[model samples]
Structure formats: C-alpha cells, structure tokens
Target: MMWKTVLITIFAAGVLADDFSQITAVVTSQCTKNNAEDKVPEVEAALRTFGNCLKGLVDLNVLKTEIEEAKPNGALDEVFKKYCDKSAQLKGCISSVLQGVRPCVGNEYANHINDAQNSTNQLIDFVCYKDGDRIALFIAEGGPECFQQKTENLKTCFLNLKQSFPTVESANNLSLVEKCAKVDEMTSCIVKSLEECSTPTPANMAESLIKFMRKDSPCHTALPVSIV
Candidate 1:
C-alpha cells in the first residue's frame, strides 16, 4: 500500500516538473539580439520570478502515505493547467514589449516617434514665432509652413542649442531665447506622445497630443515595425 502511494506521488511530481521546465524554456528562448544572445541578465531574473510564482503550488512531498492513496484528483490537474494558461499570457506581453526593437515593431514605435517629432516642431513654431529671415518672440504664429524650411539642417527642432550657445547667454535675453526655444521643443514631444495614446483625433493636428496606443493597429504588424 505504501509503495502504491509512493508511485502515485512520484508520477504527479514528475508531470509537474516537466511542465514547469517547459515554461522556463519558453521564456528564456525570447529576448535575444542579433547574434542570438540574450539581451541581459535582467531578463533571466524576471523570468525566474514569473516561473516561481506560477509553480508555488508544486511541492507535494508534504503529503503523507494516506493523503496520496486517494489517487489523483481534479485539484492536481488544475495546477498544471494554470501554468499553461498563464505562460501563454506572459508570452504575449513579452512579445509585445520586444516588438519595439523589431523592424515592424520599430516602425510602430517610430510612428509614435515621428508623431512626437511633428508635435514638437509645432510647439517650436508657436513659441519661436519665426518669420521670414527674422526670428522674434513677439511675432505672429506661423503655420506648418514655418517648419517647411529649415533654420539649419535641423527641420524638426528649429534651433540647435548645441551650435546656438555662444556670447549670447552672458550677453542677454537673445541667448536665453535661443536656448529655451530648443529645450521647450523636446518637452512638447514627450507631452504629445502621452496625448496621442489617450486623445488622438483626425480633425486636429494637436490631436497628436491625444495619441492612442494601438498595439494591434495595422501600424504595428504591417509597417516597418513588428515583433518576432
């Protein structure tokens, strides 16, 4: 009778071990770079946490002979089923995040990046109010056409602070104006991305500010960006 209980317990534990091992491999197989190298140690750490949490019910050694004699029940089966179910879910979320580096996924991220760039440029126009060859703070707002021409080779950011800094800062507001013009543009881009995900609209260019994060959008799978 004791041998019968031991056999059942060993069988159950073996099945559980096999399922858990497969889940570990499924997670480790992802997150690689060009040479098939794992991205980082951090990825392993995260996978361990996920695997451990899922298999926390796995230790059956505590069951004595009488407890095991009852034979396999639905409860034991449910534990293995939960692992397969949750591993699938974790796989999907990881795939989505990794898509960011993929060509298709990169393109998707780029769309947001491009939208972010356009939105940033608009804020530059609103703030710099560049007109003709002359730039002044008090001038009227320019349309998209203001960005049509480059102040330098930089079409998106109106002024390059890297080159603009000079005798201007110690000299007067002109330097300050030049410095702020570029910095403010970066701020606009960040804010616009948040908006696009939340409040996107076709009627409004400012709607870039209301961006909707469409992971399943055709943009993610069809264009230059996609997950592997």
Candidate 2:
C-alpha cells in the first residue's frame, strides 16, 4: 500500500506538469499573437500564485477538513470568492490600465497596447473563468475521483474545413449563396464530428470549441504604419 501510494503521487505530479505546460503553450501563443510578449512573465507569475491556491482544492490539503462537512457548490463558491475573484479583478485592472495608457504612448505604439489589453481580458474570461466554472461543475459532480473515468473516456474530435473549402466552389471565390451553403455544411460537419466523440468532458469540449470560435471570429484591422 505504501509503495502504491508513492507511485500514484509521482504519476500525478508528472501528469500535472504536462497539463500545466500545455496550458502555458495555449496562453503564451495567444499572448505572442496579440503582441503582448512582454506581459508573459507577469501572466506566468500570476498563474503560479493561482496554482498554489488551487493545490489546496485539488489535493484537498487546504480544505480537507471543511470540504467534508460542506456542500459541493457551497465549498467551491467559497474558494472562488477567496482566490479567483481577486486574481480576476487584478487582471481586469491591468487590462484597463493598458488601454488607458495607449494614447499617451503615441499612435505608433497604440496598436500594441490595444492588442495587449484585448488578449489579456480574453484570456482571463475565456480561459481562466471558464475553466474555473468547469472545475466547479466537476466538484459538484463528485470531484477529481469522479473525473478520472471521464478523462479516460473523453475524445477530442476536430474537423478542419479550410478557408478555401468554402471559396473553392467559385474557383477560389464564394458567392453570397455559396458562402451561406458552405457555412451550413461546416456546421453540419462539426455536429456530426461531435456526435462521434464518446462522452466528452468539459476539458475535451473546449479544444474544438475555441478553435471553431477563432476560425470564424473577425480579426482586428491591421494598424497603419506611422509617418515619421
């Protein structure tokens, strides 16, 4: 029993390290695209702090005593209020500051500031808060032990329809009617692909959902080069 416990602890640590690296890649990629590379260090620092708080919840080391007596949603809400709320507020404040400082930094630098702010807030809302909600739901449904089977059963299904797929009907150009038809086809393809995934959990569901959103979402207009 002692040897088994030690092995489980080592395995869990390895899995956690891999999971954290993947999450870091996703957030850093977004930061680079948004031209906010300088903010990466700060974002990482915040994540580390947040991770410590989360350790308590995940390992049940921090709330072990209280959680047994408390309701699932109630205990989770308490943790969120204590930890996540403060981090969210801090991220929001930093984003606001970046936006506010844009004009003073001159037009040449304004675009960078706007991108930085936009990406930061998006990360906070879409990644941090959304994942937090997922975790809360996981706890409500019986926590990490319950999710082990879910993670094993979950399948990530992706159907990539290139931009040219819709345009190809008109020799790399799409008519209004053709565009609408292609959009319908794309939607159907995605639905069919999802149907094939055997029992998806929240973590698996996000992979394709975010990709689809990014594919269809409008990009910000490129900033004009400033005349000297």
Candidate 3:
C-alpha cells in the first residue's frame, strides 16, 4: 500500500515536471538572443527575469523520475491529461509577465536622442504644414534657377538636421539612440504579434518577438525631400 502511494506521488510529480520543462523550454528559446547590439537594456532585463522565473519552476528530480517511468502504454499522456489547465496557467503567466514589463519599455529613442527628436519633429511639421511646398512655390515665382537653388537648400537642411546633435553628446547619445530605436521597433513588432496570438503562451510570445527581430529590418527609411 505504501509502495503504491509512493509510485503514484512520483508519477504525479513527474507529470508536473514535464509540464514545467515544456514551459521553460519555450520561454528560453524565445527570450535568448545572440546579438546584444540590437537590444535595449530594459527589454533585455525583462526577458532575463521572465526566463529565470520560468526556469525556476522546473523540477529536475521529478523530470528524472518521469524519464525513468517512460512506458509504451501512454502513462505519461494519461498523467498529462490530468493537468488540462497547465497550458492556460502558462498563458496567464505570460500575460502577467508582459504586463509587468511593459511599463519599463518607453520611447527612449525620441526622448533621449536629441537629433532623432529634432528630426522627427521637423518631419512632422513639414508634412503637416506643407512647408516645403510653400517654399518651392515662393521660389518658383522668382525663376527656375531660384527654385532649383531652393530645392537644393531644402534637401541639405533635411540631411543636416537629421545628422545633427550636440557635439559634446554625439558619441554617447548616438549609441543610446541606436539601442532605443531597436527597442522601439522590437516592442512594436511584439505588440502586433501578441494581437495575432489569441493565446499567447511564453513560447508563442517569444517566438513572435524572435521571428520579427531576426529579420533585422531597418527602423525607418529616410523620406525624400522634394523641393520641386
């Protein structure tokens, strides 16, 4: 009788261990990255914390027992069936982790990078106010030669402003801008992906973020400045 109870306890613990292994595997695969260059410190920290929590849930001793109890009669599957809610728990935990981490993520790119901030602001005003069109029209009334010069000046201004930052702060500020831009792009991609995943388990969410980031796409393309 005692032996029977011991065996049952081991098997039940093994089943739970299996579930934890599955959940942690998914979390680790999704959170781990190769290139640090494209990572934001806050996002990376969140990923690390989330991964560690998932890994901590795994029980190695029970996992070993599960390996020993492998039978051809599908006992493991039967045990797994008892924990129908495990998947749901994983999904809920993932949502909770993301919610906790979301507050840490911010538009550091636009906030910290003076050059990017100025460029973005200028672009917004130019597009919204049609400043370029008015300048082009004003210069065109003078002569074709004057209009051409105006167009050149507009292009130069756009390029110069996009590249400009305080000389004292350029080196450090540029690095921060690059990191923040990648983080912004990654956060945007992850948000879009989470919307698509009706049930975002740790694995599913991680997979989505990893898939998008692996593409290594550019953050933004330069807009053409038309003086004509």
| Best lDDT among the predictions, by candidate number | 2
Which runs of model 2 end up more than 4 angstroms from their true locations?
A: 1-73, 89-120, 126-135, 142-216, 219-228
How many clashes show up in model 2? 0
lDDT tens per residue, model 3, 6-47: 222232233334245543343333234322223334444444
Local accuracy of candidate 2 as per-residue lDDT tens digits, 1-228:
112222222323333352677545644664575577666565555445444434543454555554554553366656544455555555655554444333233344455564455444654454345445654554555534434443423322112334435232442365544444444455445444434444444334344444433333231112111111
TM-score, model 3 to reference: 0.24
Candidate 3 displacement at residue 16 in angstroms: 15
For model 1 the local lDDT of residue 209 reads: 24
**TM per prediction:** 0.19, 0.32, 0.24
lDDT to native, each model: 0.33, 0.44, 0.37
What ranking emerges by TM-score with the best candidate at the front?
A: 2, 3, 1
The alpha-carbon lDDT assigned to residue 30 of candidate 3 equals 29
